[model samples]
Each structure stands twice: as C-alpha cells, then as structure tokens.
Target: MPRLPIIHKTQLVASSRLFQVEEVHLEFSNGEQRIFERLVSRGYGAVLIVPMLDNETVLLIREYSAGTERYELGLPKGKVEPGEDLFEAANREIMEEVGHGAHHIQLLKRVSLAPGYMGHHTNLLLARDLYPATQPGDEPEPLEVVPWKLNRLDELIAGNECTEGRSLLALYMVRDLFMRLNR
Candidate 1:
C-alpha cells in the first residue's frame, strides 16, 4: 500500500453558520506538495433512512434543496444531534420528513459524499415496520411524501427529480439487502 500523505498544516479559510472551509497542506512521499480546500465537518455526522412502506414500496420525500434551488425526491435524512444515537437520529428523521416511525431499523452502511473534498459522513439505515407518526422538523415547508416502487428504481433514477447521490445510493443498498434476505 502507498504511504498516506503528511498534512503539514491546516488553516481555516472561510466560515458560515452551517459549514467551515479549511485549507490543508500535504506533502506526499515522492517530494510532492499540494494545498487543498475542504469543508470541515461538525457534529456527529448524519443519518439517511430508507423507509419501507411494504415489501415492494419505499417512502421518499420531495423537499426543496437549497443547493439545487428545486424540489428533489430523496430519502429522509438529518444530522445526528448531540447525544443521539444513529438509530435515534434515523427514526427522528423519518418521522419528521415522512410522517412515520420505524419499529425496525438497521444500519446498512456508512458512506461519504465526495471524500476528496468533504469530511462529511452519513450512515445509511434501512427502516421497516412503519407506523403513522409525525414530529416537527426544521424544514421551511412541509415535505411531500412520495411512495416509490422498489422494483422500478431504474425509472426513478432516470427521472430528473431524484438527484441526490446519497439517497439514490441508499435506495439501491436497501433493494439489494431486501433481495438477499428474501432469497
């Protein structure tokens, strides 16, 4: 294996209410040096939940994304609050975003979104045995709950609305897990 680069220095370059950008200087083993900017992570990361409405249906939410400036269909997710476990965060997010709480929740995987630049990590969870519930969320507007057929994920990905990579990845992971369990 190649040796990891040595981070010689790090400096904060920018800051906002939600994000902090930092510049890191690294020296490679081959006498190469480079400086890179990354969005530093805060808090206990996040959780993205794939809520199964039934064996074939999955619940998604259509929420307006500030980054994209439009409503995007994606799985329910939120940052893990201080002192909250990953399962607690997943259940809370599903209730807030999809109006349901899961009786069964399992951690599927931990994933990163653009590891080359961002330090954020998200835990993908599979939630099943849902019951009707709701909790106040920080969303500016009510999220539109969208029920999608798991078998037709290809169609969902083909559309322009479901563009969030993390959500899409979670959906696929859940589908694969369901298939394995049934087999």
Candidate 2:
C-alpha cells in the first residue's frame, strides 16, 4: 500500500450556506507536492433511508431538487442532526418525507458522494416493519410519497428523475440482498 499524503495545510477558498470550498496543500512520500480543492460540508453527515413498506414495496418521495431545478423521485433522505443517531435520523426523515416510521432500521453503508472532491458522507439505511406516521419537516413544499416495487427498480433507474447516485446504489444493494435472502 502506498503511504498517505501529509496535508501541510487546508485553506478555505470559498464559503456558502451549505458548502465550503477548501484548498488542500499536501506532500507525498516521494517528496512530490500538490494542491487540491474540495468541497467541505458544514454538518454532521446525512442519512439515506430505504423504507420498505412490505417485502416488495419501498416508499419513495418526489420532491424539488434545488440543484437540478426540478422534482426528483428518490428514497427518503436527510441530514443527520447534531447529536442525533444515524438510525434516528433515518426514521425521522422517512416520517417527514414518506409519512411513515420504521419499526426496524439498520445501517447498510456509509458512502461519500465524491470522495476525491467532497468531504460529505451519507449513511445508507435499510428500514422495514413500517407504520403510518408523519413529522413536521423543513421542506418548503409537501413531498409526494410513491410506493415502488423493488423488482421494478430498473424502470426507476431508467427514468430521468431518479438521478441521485446514492439512492440508486442503495436500492440496488437492498434488492440484491433481499433476492439472495429469499433464495
């Protein structure tokens, strides 16, 4: 394995409400130096929940994505609040976006969207044994909850609205796990 680069210093090149641009100065073991710019998120990470309404159906949400400037169809997800557990954040996000709460929830994986250029991480959560519930959320508009069959994930992926990489990979992972378990 190659040695990790030593970070000489990191400077804040830009700042925004939700993200900060950082310039990292580093020196490798070979005495080579390089400067890389990355986006540093300003919160405790986040959680992306796959709330299974049944053995086959998963609850999804359609909401406006500011980055895309349009509505996106994806699994319920939200940021982890300060001092909050990842599972707790997952349940809360589902309740807020899908109007449901999970009786059982487990972390599947923690992933970085763009590890090479971003410091943000999202915890993928698998939620089952769901019940109807709703919590007030900070969304500017009410979200549309859509029940989707895991078997039809290909259709969802082929659609343009399900463009979030984290959501697609999470669903694929859960689908594969469920298929293997049922075999």
Candidate 3:
C-alpha cells in the first residue's frame, strides 16, 4: 500500500446538531498539497440492519428523509450509541423502525458513504429469526415497515423511492450472501 498523505492542519469549518464539517490541509509525498472538507463523524458509528422476515423476505422501512426531502424506502438504520455494541444497536434499530427483533444477527461488513469526503463508516448487519416487537424511536412520525421479497430486488431498485446507495448496496450484499449460503 502507498503511504497516506500527511495532514498538515485541520480546522472545523462548520457545525450542526448532527453534522460537523472539517477542512483538512494535506501534503503528499510527491510535493503536492491540497485542502479538503469532510463531514466529521460523531459517536461510535452506525448500523444498517437488513432484517430478514424469512428466507425470502427482507424488512424495509419507509420514512421521511430530511436530506432528500422525501420518503425513502430502506433498511432500518441508526447510530450506535455510546457503550452500545454493533449487534445491540442493530437490534434496537430494527425494533424501533420495523417493529421486530432478531434472534440471529450477523455482521456483514462495514461500508462508507462518500469515503472521499465523509469520515463515517456504517456497520452492515444481517438480522434473521424475527419476532414481533416495537420500541418507540426518535422519529417524528411512525415508520412504515415494508417487507420486500429478495427475489424482486431489481424491481425495488428500479423504484424512485429507494435511492439511497447504502441501502441498495446492503440489499445486494444480503441477497448474495443468502445465495451463497443456500448453495
């Protein structure tokens, strides 16, 4: 692997309730220098849960997204709170968003959103053996839980409401995983 660029300086460029932007000054080994801005991640990180309703169905949620200003259909996801392990956070988010808790949970992978400009990594988890459960979430309104068949992922991705890249990638990963396991 190549050596990483040296960060000469960093400054907080902006801040908000849920996000912080930082400007980084870097010097490369080849005598190149540049400044870049990134959204500084806060807290332990986050968990995106691909909750399986069955071997064929995955649970998704339709909730309002302030960033897109529309209702997005995606997997249940939330930050991993202080002291909460990834599995605990995954289960909690599923309970809060999809009204179910998983008896079997496995960490699939860790993914970054815009790794070039965002210092955030989300744990992608696969949750199975679901049971009915609900916990009040911090959402302003109730989330609509949608169970989607894994076999029809292409149709779901074709829809406009399911545009989040992270969610789409997680679904594909889960589908591939199940296929390999069944084989």
Candidate 4:
C-alpha cells in the first residue's frame, strides 16, 4: 500500500451533480510518476437507525431524492456538514429526518459507494434505544415512516427495494446485529 496525497485537483467535467473529474500528476522521491485519479465525488453521508420498542422493528424512511428523481426507501441519512464528526452528523440527520434520538450508536461499517468511479464514503451506524423528539427541520414533505421487521429484512434486499447503497449496507449490518442479539 502507498500513501498517496492529492497533488492537485481539477474538475474535468460536471453533469447532473456527478463530476467527471481529475487530479494533477503524482510523483514520489523515488521518481515514480502517475496521473492522479478523480472519481465522482459526493464526499460523505450517514446512516441513521432507530430500534423499535421490542427491538424487533427498525425504523426506515421513504423519501424522494432530487438527484435520482425517484423515491428511495432507506434509513435516514444526510451529508456531513463542514468540520462535523460522522456520529454527530448521523445523530442530527436521524432527528431531522425522523424525529428520533438514539442512545446507543455503534458504527458498523464505512463503505465506498463506488470505488470505481465515485469518491463517496457512506458511514454506517447501528443506532439503538430510541426516543421521540421534535423533528429537526424541514425536508421533503410527507416523509413515510416504515417499520421494518427484523425477520423481514431480507425482503427489502431481495425486492431490491432500496436504491441507496449506504442504506443497504446499514440494513445488512443491522441483520448481523440481530443475529448477535438473538444468541
């Protein structure tokens, strides 16, 4: 493995919020030269969770995304604000999107949404012990609250119900958590 830093960055192209981009040439003291690679960069996102009372149901949200121009069934998520910690962002997004607060937040995974063509990183959080709170702020109207049964988790996966890769990964982690809890 090599520690590569961005020598220079430039946006080669931008279309529909996805940038076909590039960075300047890279060089090492050992005299190795290579062009810096740039992928579609969305930076970062969060996965929010709410465990139902019996600890059997997980709260999910269905909301419309302008970028995709379609409704996506996913766990609550949002971009991280400047200089914000990932967990803080996750907590804030959960409250804002679902009006819920989580007591136990375990980071299940960190995923690269498109290692081939995107510089996006989605943080997966396993949140438990939830309580109601006033909604954080305005988002798309008519946010649908879906109670996802732990046993039926695969239904969503099998149905290909979720479009966000981050949400899918989060649910997969929750499934793993469920297996651990059942033991």
lDDT (tens digit, per residue) of candidate 3 on 1-183:
658999999999999898899999999888799999999988899999999998899988999998889999998999998889999999999999999999999998999988999989999999999999989999999889888999999998777879988899999998999899889
For each candidate, what TM-score against the reference?
Answer: 0.97, 0.97, 0.96, 0.76
lDDT of 2 by residue, 44-106 (tens): 889999999888888889999989899999988988898889988999999999989999999
Better of 1 and 4 by TM-score: 1
**lDDT to native, each model:** 0.93, 0.92, 0.93, 0.70
Worst 10 residues of 2 by lDDT: 13-22
User: After superposition, which runs of candidate 4 have C-alpha atoms over 4 Å from their true positions?
Assistant: 1-20, 23-37, 40-53
Kindly give the number of clashing pairs for every candidate. 0, 0, 0, 0
> Across residues 44-84, which tens digit of lDDT does each residue of candidate 1 receive?
99999999999889999998888889888898998999989
Cα lDDT tens digits, model 4, 10-66, are: 546435564566655656555677675666565455445544535688888889888
* Global Cα lDDT for candidate 2: 0.92
Prediction 3 TM-score vs. true: 0.96
